[model samples]
Target: MLQLEGLTRRFGANTAVDGVSLSVPAGQMVGVIGRSGAGKSTLLRMVNRLTEPSSGRVIHDGTEVTALRGQELRDWRTDCAMIFQQFNLVQRLDVLTNVLVGRLNHRRGFGATLGTLFKRFSAAERAMALSALARFDLAEQALQRADTLSGGQQQRVAIARALMQQPKLILADEPIASLDPRNAQVVMEALRDVNRRDGITVLCNLHHLETARHYCDRIVAMQKGRVMFDGTPAALTAARIRDIYGVSEDEFDTAPEMTAPALTPAREAALPA
Candidate 1:
């Protein structure tokens, strides 16, 4: 289990994530939804320690996450893989080599690390990377430069890299914000596949309510850095959504609807079990 006790972060006088606390169990797919500047990204960053918390504690499976340092912190980050809005891949590198980079933390001593830097990995590791790529239907593109693939393809490559870490949890911050509707559906399905098949817990920050409703097991809504609602997708009523977005009921009714396409059998089969 992952527990956040009064987690807070402040910059100058403005608090980004305010005294928020939550307990997430393993194998749950959670969607964190909120408007822009609602502190959703900051909350995930604090959990990953990419951004330090000003106060409170982050405990994961009995380990004090907020107090870890050096290798311990690095290991924590490895176990909790982060997928960003920008994909964060080495554009110049081949997809396979970029995926192999996830093993950098597992590389022990100077020689191993140096070998990884030069793109030298064990045969078993190479096979593992290939398997991850195949999981996302990117194995054939493994030798292509990352920049050459489409946005959705690059994001899948990023997911493949995360899988190479064998992460227990995934923190996805606006992962599909930049993709088109079709690609967004594909990416979200990939995330759901990992959560279901591999039993990896997912905490994804989503902008679209319908997408979250369709994909997540539970929904946590934030407003101005505070969690305003926490419940199953069906329990997130229209009134609650309006309240979280601070919009009038009429405005909410007229808002453009964004929904992911239904997954077909062929596409579902394409994603590895």
Candidate 2:
């Protein structure tokens, strides 16, 4: 389990993440939803240790994650992978090499470091990286440059790279915010598959209420750096969304039929069973 006890982060006079506390059980896909600047990204960053907390503690399975440093912190990062809004890839590198980067944590010794610097992978390691890409149907594009693929394809490559880390937890910060609707659905479904099939915990920051309701097992609503609501997707009703985001039902509702004014990609997989 992951526990956040009064986790907080401040930017001088402004607090980005307030005294927020949360406990996440294993193998759960939790979506953090809110308007822009609600501190959702800051909260996820703190959990990943990318953003140091101003105060409070983050404990994961009995370890004080906040106290880890050096190699310990690097190990923690390997165990907890992060996927970003922008698919952070080496544009010039082939998809396979990028995926193999996930294995950096497992390498040691100067020889291993030199091998990684030159992008040289042993046969077994190459197979492992290939397998990760296969999960997202990107194995066929293994030799392709990451920048050459479409936005959705690049994101899939990013996901494949994360899978190679063999992480226990995935922190996706607005993963699909930049994708087209069909691509968004594809990425979301891929994430859901990872959560269920591999039993990896996923904490995704989402912008669309319908997207959150469609893909997450639980919804965590944040407002001004604090958690405003936490419950099953079924419990996050339209009225509750209105109360949290200060928007009317229509603006927040992303139901398939309700949102599909035309056959746009955004509506293609608005809801998935």
Model 2, 1-273: lDDT tens digits are 999999997765567679999999999999998777778887998897987788999999999999999999999999999999999999999999989998899887899989898988889999999988898888899999888999999888888889888999999999998999999999999999999999999999998888998999999988778899999999998888777766765665343212112222243234221
TM-score of each: 0.91, 0.91
lDDT digits (tens) for residues 1-273 of candidate 1? 999999987764567789999999999999998766678988999999977788989999999999999999999999999999999999999999999988888877999988988888999999999999999999999999999999999999999999889899999999999999999999999999999999999999987888999999999988778999999999987877776676753454345333223234365335332
| Model 2 Cα shift for residue 197 (angstroms) | 0.2
lDDT of each: 0.88, 0.87
Runs of candidate 1 with Cα error greater than 4 angstroms are: 248-273
What's the C-alpha lDDT at position 37 in model 2?
A: 71
What lDDT score goes with residue 227 in model 1? 96
Cand. 2 TM to true fold: 0.91
Clashes of each: 0, 0
